[model samples]
Target: MPLDRRSLLLGSPFLLSGCVTSPATQRPSQAAISRPDMVEADYASIYAAVDGEPFPVPAIDLQEIEPEFLRRAVGYRTAERPGTVVVDPGERYAYLVGEGGRAIRYGIGVGKEEGFNFRGAATIARKAQWPRWTPTPDMIRREPQRYGRYAGGLAGGAGNPLGPRALYLYRDGRDTLYRLHGTVEPWTIGTMVSSGCIRLLNQDIMDLYRRVPVGSRVVVLGSGGGTAV
Candidate 1:
């Protein structure tokens, strides 16, 4: 049986530690309100692809996801300026700080174990649509049987693991090799299952990619609650 929203929210440690309740009367910003698909969308409407999107993003079944993982407006009290993207891996949530005291929150899948320990500030140096995927040398060495086939690279497509979009992370002038990208398996949202990549639902990522520019700041907090950079 598929995991329901209530079951996952009640059972998942991330949700317990991560979710903060906001007053019902706080309204979303103009930008948030404009996205009816995100602000007030049902599962079916939320899952539908936006017109003229460069890549294919298949509609997803909302029942397959925990409700908390769905994109929504939240009262986020953060010092970070608006347009900054802060990822709390422990909470399995990504916050796009907005004007006022609110944020556009999106559910995400994070890396396992130490992969969650990645702490620091980086800039989104590049963005891609239907980006190609390549396994790192360490990834291939660790699991050659699983990754060797993609030793060269995998073309972007509906079946590509990177899904429809990718935001490359960089620090100083170097590529951190960490990415904020979409996933083919939306069911994996709110879980620890990636190789240090931050995973978002295809639809959610498309929205984020459009709003987040190449020079946007990305702060990934540490497990110890210390800010990275």
Candidate 2:
């Protein structure tokens, strides 16, 4: 993913650590918005080619930025710590466990391989916006039919598959074959998608990327799951 200088910050107060700040309602000077498909040329296209006709994004029924979903604990317990991200692929939920047993959880899309999905612990090593997407060689090899279009490289923007933002996950100072990034095909959210990367709706990711900071710890679990550094 080509993460450049793009920026995002969710509005409203961050409720944490017994301290209540004002709602983080302030938008950045440059709010990123997805481009339309019907526009003309010369806009750094970054979309994957469709084998058939393109389908409109499906209507996702879930809580969005406003009126955040009131989640019920899945009868799950933990050592009970905050400031950590735990991803449970079986539940398709990423819980940002917060103070007082509260968590800001969101639905996520995971990899297809059972145990090969990212798990363990890591941090937000880096992040970018409208990031240039370079499909890993393995991804190309796995699905040449789908990825051959970018045998070379693809710029960022409309056709770009990385959507709007990309948060790179790293462990042991090495690149994990995983990423938290925006999805152009919003319908893919809450489904088994991606060769390995974790995906979110463009709008949702845009909202998340803005709230999280670099070096935030993340723990992934599922399939042949092994936790990251």
Candidate 3:
């Protein structure tokens, strides 16, 4: 069968073989060899399909995801206070600052180009569930054939690129147009492939949505620079 978005997202067994190299040619990374603190059953439950929303969210196939990219708690030492969101595009990780030198780290897919990524402090002034997505004017100009048709906007749903939730970023009381949202292409997590927004797995973004609220601070680090943007 041809690989559709859903098929690729679900990590169909037949598709999996072609997605990665054979064990004969390459060895698994240490991160992949060592499992997270959570067991198989725990991961299954954590990433299970979510209901009770405007639309159903399909479960993520862990096999399609990198082990390091899976959501997990880690010791993070940062001056930022709890509830702050620190996005490290260089590492492709978003850290939700927590108390006691710890954080809930979620792997993220970022802008493919450094120039396209947002680098600065902003506030989560608004949020939406299954939010509408409209390509920016620049996006339309750059790729008319790809984005011009959606200039008006695309309604939120399972098929939408902005998957399940979106945390809108604002600076100086104005919308920055940079968002932290979910993606239908869960396999893209941990890679730099988005236009500009940071994308999380549908399940992971929902978890973050429940944890964060409007008015939260968001700091996106400069590409390859540890300095706060």
Candidate 4:
């Protein structure tokens, strides 16, 4: 069958291959590897689709999501060479510039005003599947009651706010402490709610996670936002 978004997002977690960590070592439980299906589920149940399945993306209501935010290929003209990631935060889109004046675009959720803007160049230093999350010291200090419990770290899982994948950004070989990662809340896409990380819908993040190579270049435009890979 011709590949569709559902197949790309819902068929195989290994669709791209070589990006996954050993399940035995990364997942907290077997259930995290294979879980239940999501059927006509509400937004709250979205996490059920991603909890621990080998193919963890769930079908979301496209009608509810803006068409521009959905992943698609488009004719794009840019000076940046192919394989570069360009993020336009003001417009809320991330583009993977491809060969021949084309680009793959995905809608993104950005950080709030405090974490909303940064300018400069960075590289994809690392990638992780279902990455562990630690509330930053700044985050804890700002909201202790909310972030204190997870200060040490939260294991990768559906319940973890980072969702199923993370691309760590680096500049000059130093960690930026920013990430482009999956979000448990699909509805959050195309919004600005996060502290500093760039968030994509879980399925979209997985799609992006597979395409981006380690050491890829990422450019955040104007006052926009993006992690790295």
Which candidate tops TM-score?
3
Candidate number achieving the greatest lDDT relative to the actual structure: 3
Candidate 3, 1-229: lDDT as tens digits: 1113553243312111011100011222234223332223256767877766778788788899999998877877778888899999899999888767777788998776666678889999999998887756654565577556667777778767677889999999988878888887888889867657888988778878877889999999885533321
Candidate 2: RMSD to truth? 14.8
Give me the displacement of residue 48 in model 4, in angstroms: 13
1 or 3: which has the higher TM-score? 3
Q: Give TM per candidate.
A: 0.78, 0.61, 0.79, 0.72
Per-residue lDDT for 1-229 in model 1, tens only?
A: 1113333223212211111000012222445545523465454666665455565566777788899999877777778888899999888988888777777888998865563345789999999998887756765665577557767777777666677888888889888878888876778889876657788998888878878888999999775432321
- Worst window of 10 by summed lDDT in candidate 1: 15-24
* lDDT per residue as tens, model 4, 48-166: 24444543556565566776687666777778878788877777788887777777777887755633455567899999987887755665565577557767777776566667788
Scored against the true structure, residue 22 in model 2 reaches a CA lDDT of 15
Alpha-carbon deviation at 116 in model 3, angstroms? 0.8
Full-model lDDT for every candidate: 0.69, 0.51, 0.71, 0.62
Give the Cα-based TM-score of candidate 3 against the true structure. Answer: 0.79
Q: Give me the displacement of residue 21 in model 3, in angstroms.
A: 23
Error of 4 at 127 (Å): 0.1
Candidate 3's C-alpha runs over 4 A off are: 1-41, 142-146, 223-229
Q: Look at candidate 4 and tell me the lDDT of residue 143.
A: 55
Cα lDDT tens digits for candidate 2, 18-51: 0111111122122222211111221111112221
